[model samples]
Target: MDFQRTLLIGGLAIVGYLMILQWDKDYNQVPTTTQQQEQHQTVPSTEDAPQLTQAKQGASDDVPMLDSVADAPTDDTAADKQVVTVTTDTFAVEIDTKGGNIVKASLLKYPVKLPDDNEPNPAPFTLLERSSARTFIAQSGLIGPDGTDSKGKATYQAAQTNYQLNGGETLNVDLSLVDKKGVKVIKRYTFTKGSYEVKVSYVVDNTSSTTWQANLYAQLKRDNTQDPSNSSSSMGMSTYLGAAVRGKEERYVKLPFDEFEEEKFNADVTGGYAAVLQHYFVSAWIPNQEQLNNFYTRKAGSNNIVGFKNQNNPLKLAAGEKGEISATLYLGPKDQKRLAELADGLELTIDYGVLWFVAQPLFWLLTFIHSLIPNWGWSIILLTVMVKAAFYPLSAASYRSMANMRRLSPKLQEMRERYGDDRQKMSQAMMEMYKKEKINPLGGCLPILVQMPVFIALYWVLLESVELRQAPWLGWITDLSVKDPYFILPLIMGASMFVQQLLNPTPPDPMQAKVMKLMPIIFTVFFLFFPAGLVLYWVVNNLLSIAQQWMITRQIEGQAAAKSTK
Candidate 1:
């Protein structure tokens, strides 16, 4: 009966955990707003410009003529399009001069795969590409009268086809274009030695007699195609692939591809950022903090666009005057520390489920431990030890309660046999026995309830931490983020769980006893698909728990025996 009650509590905790995961998935499916409906109706074809009357009217009173220019022709000639390559320590980017768009970006340090026979030397991980089947690129342009942008019908000329950092502190790639009206626009891309962020700025030099007026727009364009490399062991474990926007009222707003197709997101925010997020990497455009910007997310045919544009407060540059508009672009692995430094709430991209408050500190601790011990696997082991030590007193009490119950198991069985079919009498007799023994029937369940959040939070920390990707532990444990190659750790965990179960008191009910006996097998099957790091943590934790419970039970039984003899 006691075991049945404990199982009920465990079942409730598992149900709650599953509910949180489901809620998070559903939360990303945001409701369609009225503005989104209007924008959806106004979204024009690929060959035309999006109608801006509704958006312009909704703009702040300060800006009157805020509108987006017509999109560039989809069938632009690629034969003559010049490609500029910028090589930095962290990444290599290829930009097309047609609109100064970053069409191809490869993480120079990260390989596409750990090792493969087909490709002896695997290529670098490609973050952005422009192929016939897939189109993912970072695009920016100017919108308004006399503005020359890549997204528009303006072509730029690059100064050089290749630019290398070559151990230098900074490297710059310049793409220049002169409008028919003689407005010279130089698009400069600045890359640092060891940073993924590229500083993109446009130097608009008005060479004509009239003033140059336009708004700078930057966006990420990608299709709904999923990356084959992001597969998980199960369907429920798929990573989120979509857009996220940070604004004044909204901290972290997710705009999924399906949701974007149903409704667009349009808002004006100061110090905002728009990003396209995937499993381990993210590409975001963070505009100047002091400027008010218009952030939007919409779908164009098979592609999804997420971007922000500086408010249409025209950069009125007179003849011979030059104006520079700049923003930072981040394209690399989602390192929480670096991402947080880049923009507010950017670290949220490394999702830790719904219990972020608990997961964040746990991740910080894990990182700190990793700093001290280079091996992430060892860090997880030490983290489990620390967590167990923190809850030692509660666990000891729970163990002692179970020990008391185990000591009285014979009496409990006799009472059950005597009361046969009378459940009321059996329960009453069990309550009296518990009261006389000064044992709390629910004490053993409390420790488990308390540990559930910590364990679940650590699960996310292991799942989301890129530092564990391809990280090796001992022999055969090549990637801590992946399942054990031999399934040894899971088997060991199951053995330890079985040992711990044997130490607990047997349930009076035969049905409950059978269910309890199968728990270790059930958990072992589940852990077979979990990451090695998480499985390692559970194995270590279970071993330590068995040892602690054994010692506590022995002490309690010794005292009870002495009292009975006296």
Candidate 2:
């Protein structure tokens, strides 16, 4: 086979591989008035239903049951709805007084849409919601022999309906509950100054004659709703939208919603966590790391739940004794460093795929460049240049080989004409000419093959990093992590690719030449929907390649002309 023919087909295969990596994502956008719509849920609720009940009713399967224990009915099934709102520097959360559940939460730092200076402050992105369209909430309670939620939803009383933390290091929101039997329980939610992890604790004051024995359960219940925060949804480039658990053997295990019926996910995990992941954010239950807990995924009524429960022994307290049971809930962006600090393998949520080894270093370099330049777009360009420089020697050798091939193109064409239909003679003449010229037909192809993994790894880094969300570089390129609105970068990249091809020797075969001519156009259209950052990288890389190839080609041609004159 002709080496040029092989190279052209190989290039097409790489493009095909990239298209396969991207899958279509169905985006069912929520109504613009999600805030107003959330005020009244679609769930059929009693005029005076329990406050927590309204938020926990995404589906019938929202709550979990203990082994051999059925939940008993509650006396206040029609209790009035009541919630305590807490506002901090990083969060706006609503806690239901009934179960002390985090019924609604808004990430104060992130907005539902990019802010327009002309418009009022954009509303905070709603991370947890309770409505007919979306049901995602954080629920936790004591559920064992004498658990509050074991006998239906537990109700509590808060001192105030609203709380705020500003210029303070920490804030605490407390809800109190006292049973008729004299057992008092205080559910406290602790928030730090700028942290997304909220500690949900249950302080039990067991004053009853009998011992208080109950296990703590924390879980996230959500529907299979589309990820609204996914800005990387260009041409169906979707991120993971499912549950991920920390495995003893593996760093991360993905539990997709569609796999719920295939089998029940139940495991005894020590010092582990369970979480529901979306495009840029995740809500996780990082249980007490010291205790051995049970991590599970199951359907509650119509809801899919991923959470943890205490194993081995329930919290036991004798009469007149007091104790506490608590777990931390992280609800915010998936910052790698912060997530890694929260729990082991939490940072894996920022998935870089099989080439994480290569992607990790690329991300580090990209971030290091950003730290120096202070602009993600400019930083990306610098990173690309550095990457090109690192491979300069290899690229130079490949360009030299191509230049040599171009110098011999006319001679090979003359031989093809001389042999006419004698294919055997043509092959022998081509081999002798190549050997005489000391040319290795495969030389130019190896360099690109060697660099493919590195480039592919960079693709994932640009797609997965949340730090680049909404970051801008110069005019018209607002968000580096999203597709360009005007598509200027893709056009530039396409043109650069075409120019790079012009620097190479055109294939002698008509069919091969046609495919080579179409490559740039095909890639330009394919990149139209790619993230702006990725396209910027490609455009810069191609421009550099064209300059390098042109210089090498000119030098090689000059030397050939000198030799012919001699």
Which one wins on lDDT? Answer: 2
How far out, in Å, is residue 450 in model 1? 1.9
Off by over 4 Å in 2: 1-60, 66-79, 415-428
Which residue pairs in candidate 1 collide?
99-150
What lDDT would each prediction earn against the true structure?
Answer: 0.79, 0.81
Superposition TM-score, candidate 2 onto the true structure: 0.87
lDDT of 2 by residue, 1-566 (tens): 69999999989967764554343322422345455455545564332243465346422233455662223344445356598999999999988776778878999888766766643577888889776557788988888788887766788888899999978899989899888678999999999998999998999999999988988888888888777677455463678888998877776888898786566688887888898988789999998888888888876555677888885658899999999989999999989888898889988888888999999999999999888899999999999999999999999999999999888988978987899989888888888988999998778899988988998898888888888888898898888877776667877898898888888877867799999999998998788778898899899999999999999999999999999999
**Per-candidate TM-score against the hidden true structure:** 0.83, 0.87
With candidate 1 superimposed using the best TM-score fit, by how many Å does residue 555's alpha carbon deviate from the native? Answer: 1.9
Candidate 1 stretches greater than 4 Å from native: 1-79, 115-120, 149-153, 227-229, 232-236
Top TM-score: which candidate number? 2
lDDT for each residue of candidate 1 in 1-566, tens digit (9 for 90 to 100)? 99999999989957865664466456522223333335534653231223354234332111112354223323243346677998888888989787788988989887665664655576677788776435688887776666664223357887678889996899888888888888888889999989999999988888899877887888898888785335433322666788999966967888888887678888888877999888778899999877788888776656788898786455679788989988999998989989988888888988887888999999999999999999999999999999899989888988988888899999998997899999999999999999988889888889878878988888788888878877888888978876675667978999899999999999888999999999998898787667788889989999999999999999988998899899
